[model samples]
Target: MIVLKAEVFNDGRHTGENIAAKLETMLSSWGIPKENVLCIVRDGGTKMKKGISLLIIKNIDCLSHQIQEKFENEEDPLLWWKVNSNKYGILSPVAKEYLVTPPTSVLSERVFSGAKIFYIPHRNRLHGERASKLLFLKFNIPSLQFNY
Candidate 1:
């Protein structure tokens, strides 16, 4: 397994030298050479411990993850077409006028917050299901189909 050590001190709270010492101790015990490990130092005038300066090591990147990342980086017209589609639950006329965007985050926040509130008995028996459908309709505001 390839080990990566990075200096994660933003406000001089930590140091790269301190990190290397810890890595050296850990790697030494595992019978791994010091050259095998990699250390990334933070930029700017920050004081680290002592000897931990710069250690560079090469590691193989996962092919699957790399391909997935590449795909994510590339722009696909089909995706944009779907994103602009009314069925994708993004763009809406009523939503555009009033609501800025879909309330996904608000709903998530509400889920946690709502759990604390009193168990208010719903008015309708199928209110939960109806509400979900209404939410879908609200976000995916229907566009007139041009049946040519």
Candidate 2:
């Protein structure tokens, strides 16, 4: 998880088209080829859904909060994926990409998300970086204004 970009949303219009345009500009600046986007996890806002659809990538409901609950009561998901990656074959890589996804984006957006699941044993060896920092990066999303 890393903070790649940050900017103010001076224009308070959170329309889907406007959001998509802003997203495209950011993606362009980051040199992220549009086609590489496997999926997007978004909140239950109409504009959010529309904007994600505009990107033409798979969109998933924001399930990070639920992930915390699951972790508290069950097994680690990343570890599960690592163990089952071979069994799933092609889907394994897809799971990896989605596992790192953030829930949403705002002014201080996180380019890469899903770091909240980093509480596993391996997190302590993350080059001396703090777990809180990783969680912050995971929650960072590109800036946009919308009703939630």
Candidate 3:
């Protein structure tokens, strides 16, 4: 398993197209077989062309972007924004911008959330998927106090 640290950007110039190309180049340079590589891009709306190119090059894709997309596209847009805002917070306008148009870096949030799931505990109970969802709804909905 080769872990090449890279900063993925959703910027037009640094889109999945360029990222995938870079992965291929990096793997080849390191003498790693393309088939042995796994490319975990943090882009959810990546067009099929870019995804197919990565797959054809034999890198396994991470589902973080897909999961984020699924949550964001839920029936209730308010709930979605609330969840994201609670997660991203208002400390940085850049983070707020990401909540609206998620940049590639948002994948880090997802990864750390997964880690938090394993770490945080409530009343000596490990929060399972159902409880976690409920907690997310509870915390995210009631905590939203808009200044407007």
Best lDDT among the predictions, by candidate number: 2
lDDT, candidate 2, equals 0.63
Model 3 error, position 116 (Å): 30
- lDDT per residue, candidate 3, 91-138, as tens digits? 234544555644577755765665564465554565568666765664
The 10-residue segment of model 2 with minimum total lDDT is 64-73
What TM-score does prediction 2 earn? 0.41
Tens digits of per-residue lDDT for model 2 on 1-148? 3556755557988898887777778778999887776444445678867876898755555555223323433777778878776655556688888777465564224323444366557665764357667665445533333335
- For candidate 2, give the lDDT of residue 73: 38
Which of the predicted structures, 1 or 2, would earn the higher lDDT when compared with the native? Answer: 2
Please give the range of 10 consecutive residues that has the lowest summed lDDT in model 1: 60-69
lDDT for model 1, please: 0.46
lDDT of 1 by residue, 1-148 (tens): 3554333444554465655565566666788786754433333323332334433333223333332322354666455444554542333343344534455698756655544332346634545666666555544554534343
RMSD of each: 17.9, 15.2, 17.2
